[model samples]
Target: MNKYIEIIKNAYTGYWNYLKHELISINHWDNYFYGLLCISLIVWLLEICFPWRKNQSIFRNDFWLDTFYMFFNFFLLNLIVLIALSNTAAQFLNDILSFIGISISSFQLFDVDDLPKVLGLFIFFVVGDFIQWNTHRLLHRIPWLWNFHKVHHSVKEMGFAAHLRYHWMEPVIYKSLLYIPMAIIGGFDAQDVAIVHFFNIAIGHLNHANLGWNYGPLKYIFNNPKMHIWHHAKNLPEHSKYGINYGLTLSLWDYLFNTAHIPYNGRDIELGFEGDENFPKDFIHQELYPLSKK
Candidate 1:
């Protein structure tokens, strides 16, 4: 009982300190709070200047709702709950492993420490993206996961901020699956991969933005607005009952695995799923909608 209490206390303190550092520290320019703000502002400016749907309003439908989701999922919820919970979970997992005499540190596929810095970072980035891509597919294929993922697909109009409009359970799922694989390929610090993280965040914003960019030849390598819009299209391909274009950062997986689908320019495609007209429009209801018996 004392051990559990200590873990909970330490988790809250550690996350609070980390949050404070992220908010005020200037020593690290790679802070996520500022990074998210900068990227959001840049992409939003692009959308305003060059919106693919010319008739779409600057304040598109559900715009503020999605904005709230962005900050809520990114910072507010993390500060209040997720950060502490994740920390506690990590400590508990470590304790369980210790009890079984299993040292996770002893089981690396390869240590990034011995490799060249860029190569190590590249390996970590690719593997992490691949994991997310597969997890994304599961979110569509599995019924229960899709219920949680519905918050993201409920977007009636896509925009840059829509990138982060997901159920809070998503991070729990993504990070839980990510932990073991990342642990096995250890020695790289979070700071070491900040560049990749920021780049992915930018791509994610672009993918959800009201832009029509397909990246031309790079469409095969990277995900872009054109390819990703179809991911949110109201009408899924008859063949793709689960979903299509499951790529999170890279399009390579979708192309290689044959899930890629873009029959034509998707600029005017209607967004959301079949029953989306009935989906919750407010933040509070959207969060709880997934967990409801309905």
Candidate 2:
């Protein structure tokens, strides 16, 4: 009881303090709201100007759920992270590692300061993207994981808002897994992390958007709408592969891993799984639906 009380107290303190300083720094969170509004505005314009599917409605199905997910990811999930950390990420990771008998300090053997900032940032981006890509791939390939991932792919009308649509458990799984390797590295570039967050928000919105910007040859370099739409294709090339294009932020990982699957005609591609039209449209049921044995 005492421990739980302390955790709640600390969470309150941390959240209040976070709210106080959130606007003063871009890294704090002002950038998040800024990026959200900007990206949403830009996408809304582009979506109206150059829609890939002319028949789809601007409002879209599951729009409210996706809206909830955006706030959930940005605010609630982050609050969960803070609570899980008890205000300390390194200690939280060390505690988890200790429980598994893999005892290790949250420090690198060598100093990252010796490397140039740009080089260090490059390493961060590559390593982080690879970890995210692996997590995404696992979500599609594993049966249990697929249950949670199906929420995102259930939308027939893909758009900017669809990017954040995900099961609540996804951040818990992905972030916890990511912190394992990242904490071991003993370095964090706040600027690079911010840049990546901005880039991710922009690219994520564009990729799930109804707009048709293939970026041509650049499609091989970055994950674009054309490439990503195929990922949500109803009848994928094979069941073994689940769906195509698991890459996040970068397509290089998919290319190297031989998971890249793009068909010739990605236009007006059917989205969502077959025989799942009766899937729960409500938020609470959707989360529970994944874990239900029935």
Candidate 3:
């Protein structure tokens, strides 16, 4: 009865939530998925509304690629939650705190503290990406990890969908290793974690977009597309410019790490690794051939 009531309340609350220009209603449970769908559609529409000269090919690829990633990440995220991590990213946080001699819980950090829950979640999203940027850069630089990272870079185009071309093995590292450490330390609740996921998806989409929009000073600190495109460039010298724009919300780490690249010419350069020229084109080949035996 309570579950049914909650659903009714959430459904009615969405209109007010939409009017406020907020992504989700604070009081609604299912608003997260609905909000994500709305935002994803908006992103696709924006790609059509504001076309890019050099990335028309990218626009074409995005239709199928984005669809593929949407479903792909959906399945993988659920799998990790159900099977791999057992829905206890918070527990992993506690374990990491124990190792570090800190006594913190994700719930306690978000709930029992004077800090606002929204702010706490924002920090979690930012900090986790900081770690992700360095770890992702390492994956590209290190030979063994590069084997997996290369799969993502193998795409010969740039679009919103290109972001989802990551190797299948990445989620194991992203969820279990990259995210769990922060979850254990932060002690955020389910809502806080959900907001971080939202931020990740939104920022990730922006990073791979072809639109030349800039967030003014925010561009200096965030992983906007301008800097991210260079990360996917075909040139090895350019590709090594990897760790820049490490921050999803703010590029502080990129500046600190000296990996941030901001282009002045306003051009969309060619993307992907040279090795992918001979690579397969079909979805199956794109998804599997990279990891397969030759």
Candidate 4:
């Protein structure tokens, strides 16, 4: 009993320490929160001006659940798990290299200072987005991943806030996959990652907002609100016909891979899965429902 108590106490202390480090060491809380605020406002205005589904309410279906998801993601999701995972991976890799007498610091690919700030920013966006694009594809194609990903798609009435609706497990899986590619690229520090995250926060909301513009020629390059709405469309025959439009910030990948799908004026496509009515309404149920019996 004493041994078990000590083990529990140690785990609690470790968790508390991690929580403190995450809150203090990782700057950019202002950038993330305020950036999302501005994006949400812009998207909200656009939705009011040009909503795709006129009948969908300002307080749409599952609005509170989405709000819960947004706050949870902001407050909890990306902090402890990602930081701990990276630190542990770093320590493990360092230990292995130390055994082999190999110093990892000798291999910085690009000097972050030498590169133009704009170029660094672009590279940050492209690399991070590529990782996310692949993650999105895996979530749709892999059955096990699909179980967790279904929470996002279950939101039948899509809105700007729905951008943050995702399983908490997502960062763990995606961040684990991102580590190798990030190491290969090198020279990107926390600031570079923060900027890309800021850009994503804005762009992500815009893509999910109810606005109905495809941005003409730009649609081929960037994933716009219209193209993304179709991604959530349940009744669209192409859900099975073609696994369509899984790009994160850019539509270029979907075009290159032949997963892109946007018919002319395709704004009327139905959102959410056909039988998603069986999906739970509350936050707790949605989190656990995916783990229930097959």
Assess every candidate by TM-score. Answer: 0.95, 0.86, 0.73, 0.82
In terms of lDDT, which candidate is strongest?
1
lDDT of each prediction vs. the true structure?
Answer: 0.90, 0.77, 0.61, 0.75
> Candidate 3 vs candidate 4: which has greater TM-score?
4
Residues forming the 10-long window of minimal summed lDDT in candidate 3: 78-87
Task: Candidate 2: list runs displaced more than 4 Å.
Answer: 1-8, 20-30, 80-93, 96-103, 106-110, 239-241
Q: Point out the worst 10-residue segment of candidate 4 by lDDT.
A: 78-87
> Which lDDT value does model 1 have at 5?
73
Report the CA-based lDDT of candidate 2 relative to the real structure.
0.77
Report lDDT (Cα) of residue 135, candidate 2. 92
Q: Between candidates 1 and 4, name the one with more favorable lDDT.
A: 1
Clash pairs, model 4 backbone: none
Off by over 4 Å in 3: 1-32, 54-59, 80-114, 238-249
Among residues 3 or more apart in sequence or in different chains, the pairs in candidate 2 whose N, CA or C atoms overlap within 3 Å are: none
In candidate 4, stretches whose alpha carbon ends up further than 4 angstroms from where it belongs are 1-30, 93-108, 236-242
Q: What would the per-residue lDDT of candidate 4 be over residues 1-294, giving only the tens digit for each residue?
A: 454445455555676675566555545464555556667778888888888889889888877788779867765654534454555656667667889997566554665557898897787678878888999888888878888888889877778889989888777788877876676567777677777777787778888877777778998988988888878878655445425788888998999888887775666666777578898878888889778936
Estimate, for each residue in 127-184, the C-alpha lDDT of model 2 and write its tens digit: 7888999999889888888889888888878888889888877877787678757656
* RMSD (Å) of each candidate, 1 decimal: 1.5, 3.1, 7.8, 4.6
Cα error, candidate 1, residue 98 (Å): 3.0
Which prediction has the highest TM-score against the true structure? 1
- Cα error of candidate 3 at position 221, Å: 1.8
> What digit string (tens of lDDT, one per residue) describes model 3 on residues 1-294?
454445445544543454353343456753555656766777666766775545375347535765676656654444333233433444555667889887654334333234676676666766677777667766766666666766677665566666666766666566565554563455567667676677777777776666666677877667676677767766635554443444545566777867766655334566677676776666566567646743
